[model samples]
Target: MVQFHKGFPLELGPVEAFRPNDIQHAAADFPELNFGIHHMGDPYVDETISIASRFDNIFLILPLWFNQYYLQPYKMLHRLGDALLFVGAERICYGSEAFIWPHVQTYIDTLATLQMPDELQDKWGYPEITREMRENILGKVFARGLGIDIEAKKRELAAA
Candidate 1:
């Protein structure tokens, strides 16, 4: 999985920033590998989304992006819409970026309260984020990317 942090090119400087072309080449060359771009490519969200749309193996990790946008509920709705419209919910995953933020509960609470605006719902043709989709983003999707069978793991834990 690819973890890119070039979204803040201006702050990090052009030299440190991740280039979209690099991602394109990697995705094209390694079609069989799952590519996960962290921070959702931050300031380059649109470009990341565009790149992800082209490669089925590409996934956007919602770590810093979630914390950054969750407070602004409207922006969250639009961001979610763009992701859903382009790559679908299955191609996205939630990331805590724990230790760095060090406040897991705050992030959890924020996500718990997130609500998609009615206008965005109408625009995206969905009433709201469903429980299944939420589960997928929070864990199932990432588990799948890593070739982990979450259901089987659950069964094993239950049997134990």
Candidate 2:
């Protein structure tokens, strides 16, 4: 339930702060609840990444601002490396900070260097990105994570 933004940093300021300790407590009490963090929780990228690594119920979306593309490639790679190694490919999803900027594709393209998992990226990477990764990012993980019967549901909905 916390939304941490970088401009204000440590202090939540006007924004709500949802600490992991609190999240852990809530999950312990109500194990059925699903927790999701958005825009990598803005300025709390490192902390958010850490939480995703530790919690199975916690999911995150990577949007533009948190990508921090302006930083050098090595710095970007290092942070991205931590995310992939700790969070696992299935737990992470890609999203554009669309409407904030028109050329959001450039931001997503920066992931080129992370060399994400070969299974996540296409054979050659870049322009040739495949349907498998595309499906995973678009909705496969979400459907599987939520325990939805994707094929059966799709068929049922289509017939209705």
Candidate 3:
């Protein structure tokens, strides 16, 4: 797996690197390789989703976008909804950067209680957050993607 911060454009400050539309060529060029787009390309969520949706090998790591939960949680919910609706749970992963780990519980808490508004579901057809979906984003999806046996890991950790 290869991952990059989409890091570029200093004028944009610390939000994100804008859009990731230009990544298609490399993704197409390397069909057998997997690409994890960090930050979910922030304001370019649609673009990120478009790329991820088009390529089975493309995935999203959510540490940056997930930080919005500490500032504007509603926006995070919509983004989460969009990711789930467009790419589904399997491609979404909660990436806790080292700095983010200290406050990771907040992200976990917000996601734990995250729910799409009823009108949103009626209007946008976004799926309501379910326990199974929540669990996947928490780490299950990443573990499964890496071919890790979760039950075995749990036992191993317990024994430790």
Candidate 4:
């Protein structure tokens, strides 16, 4: 899996930041690998969405985006709408860059409070973020992407 973070281009140094075409080419070149773009590619959210829409193996992880939860919620919501509309909830997953930002519970709590506004939901033609969708984004989607059978694992643990 490949994780690309272009949110802070300056911190990335001379790398010139990540672009959608880069992911497009990589996905095309290596169809077997799963690609995950972190922070939903932040400032490049639309591009990320576009790339994800085209590539079945590409996924978006929400880590820094949640860290900025309170600071810029509207922007996050906007990007969330675009991603949900383009790729559906199954292709997106939640992540916590906990090693760098240790307040993991705080991020989880903030994410729990997020709800797509009714107006935006209507505008985007997507349903409200249901509990099932939230659960999928938090774990099921990622597990499925990795080809892990969560229910089977649970059953095995229960049998232990």
**lDDT: which candidate is best?**
4
lDDT of 4: 0.77
Write candidate 1's Cα lDDT for 52-155 as tens digits: 89999888788766765646767766777788778888988875344275677787666556666787777766446777777878788888888789889999
- Backbone clashes under 3 angstroms, per model: 0, 1, 0, 0
Number of clashes found in candidate 1: 0
Query: Which residue ranges in model 2 land beyond 4 Å of their true spot?
Result: 1-21, 70-72, 95-100, 103-134, 145-148, 157-160
Q: What would the per-residue lDDT of candidate 3 be over residues 1-160, giving only the tens digit for each residue?
A: 5675763344747544356876777789998777778778866777888889998778788875677776876677777778889998888887535233577666678777878888778888889888988898888867765657999999999999
Q: What are the per-residue Cα lDDT tens digits for candidate 4 across 29-121?
A: 999988888877766778788999999999888876666657777677878888888888888888534337466777767666679988888
Estimate TM-scores for all models. 0.83, 0.59, 0.79, 0.86
Question: Which RMSD values do the candidates have, in order?
Answer: 2.6, 6.3, 3.3, 2.1
Query: Local distance difference test, per candidate?
Result: 0.73, 0.54, 0.76, 0.77
Off by over 4 Å in 1: 9-11, 123-127
Error of 4 at 50 (Å): 0.6
Query: Weakest 10 consecutive residues, lDDT, candidate 3?
Result: 7-16
Q: Against the correct fold, how does model 3 do in TM-score?
A: 0.79
- Model 2 poorest 10 in a row by lDDT: 1-10
- Candidate scoring better on TM-score of 1 and 3: 1
For candidate 4, the TM-score is: 0.86
